[model samples]
Target: MTKYQLFKKLPLFAYVNKIHVRYNPGGPNTETCRKLMLMLLDPKTFTKHPYLTFTYELLSFNERPEVFLTLVPQVPFRFHADTCTLDDIHRAIDADQYKAHCDYLKRRSIESKYVQEE
Candidate 1:
């Protein structure tokens, strides 16, 4: 599948407050990280999560690449960009996002029921 197809509907992003990526433009192992940055910066991704904040840095050639995600609840997840593929990153984020979507649905249901009873 295409990278866009893989990341176009990440529900976890709805629950993400911010994302930060660090990579060295000249680093040999950072190609995937750079590609990820491009994907995250796509207009489709912005349309899907308009409120999401994204920031990135170009590190020195010797520095390691990394991606950081901050959830709405203030939890942080860190990934080593140099060691993983785009698919690996997608799978991890997808799993977390799916769970977050499920939790949001459950919370909405409970809130609605509570309101009805009151």
Candidate 2:
């Protein structure tokens, strides 16, 4: 199942099975964008497969981190900071809500392409 689908099923667990974090110094005053990616697995079936994958761009434009899903390569899927927060993740899964966000981005992406060609 895709990361989105899996996230909808599995209860949120902050314990990451695997993670990678990288920090790049922009300058003395410039805020560095820290990139992070982590994999969450179901405790009961930890050995089976990874459940959720979270990719975040922290300090984006010197602001809050932007969450993303890499369930599908080459597709940029964005999540609202408020909607996909750590608290929400721990509360309940809302695949349909986030799915709508993904759809909106997809449409915007496609529309931009057409506008560029016109």
Candidate 3:
């Protein structure tokens, strides 16, 4: 694939929370994927001054052990080089993609709480 092709654009995103659908932007005409666009928006909720926000582009997949593992070693985790997935987020449902998703949510939650405490 051309270098440009690698960064062209994505086609779909699905966000699942605890085995439940949290958000999905349905694609059309037999398309199951849509380009994922992510941005941070501070929401003005009644209880607090404002809340930091984030989102994920999720997808469906059969159960895979790699799922949670991908998000773990962000700090305290490591894998044998012989078994590494070469940092490819799509190789398994268990790589940077998951980490990115979880990190975004975590930061949002922490920021929201901090703002509330202010």
| TM-score on alpha carbons, each prediction | 0.74, 0.27, 0.21
Q: Write the per-residue lDDT of candidate 2 for residues 50-117, one digit (tens) a residue.
A: 54343333344444433443322222334444325444533333454355446557667955543466
* Among all candidates shown, the one with the greatest TM-score: 1
For model 1, the superposed segments whose C-alpha errors exceed 4 Å read 1-14, 114-118
Pairs with steric clashes in candidate 3: 10-35, 11-33, 11-34, 11-35, 12-33, 12-34, 12-35, 14-58, 73-77
TM-score of 3: 0.21
User: Higher lDDT: candidate 1 or 2?
Assistant: 1
Per-candidate Cα RMSD to the true structure, in Å, reads: 5.2, 13.6, 18.2
For candidate 1, which ten residues in a row score worst on lDDT? 3-12
TM-score, model 1 to reference: 0.74
Residue-wise C-alpha lDDT for candidate 1, range 1-118, written one tens digit per residue: 6555553666545678788899988788888888878878789988888878989998987888998987765778898899987777667777667667777777679555434663
Candidate 3 ranges beyond 4 A from true positions: 1-89, 92-94, 110-116
Model 1 root-mean-square deviation: 5.2
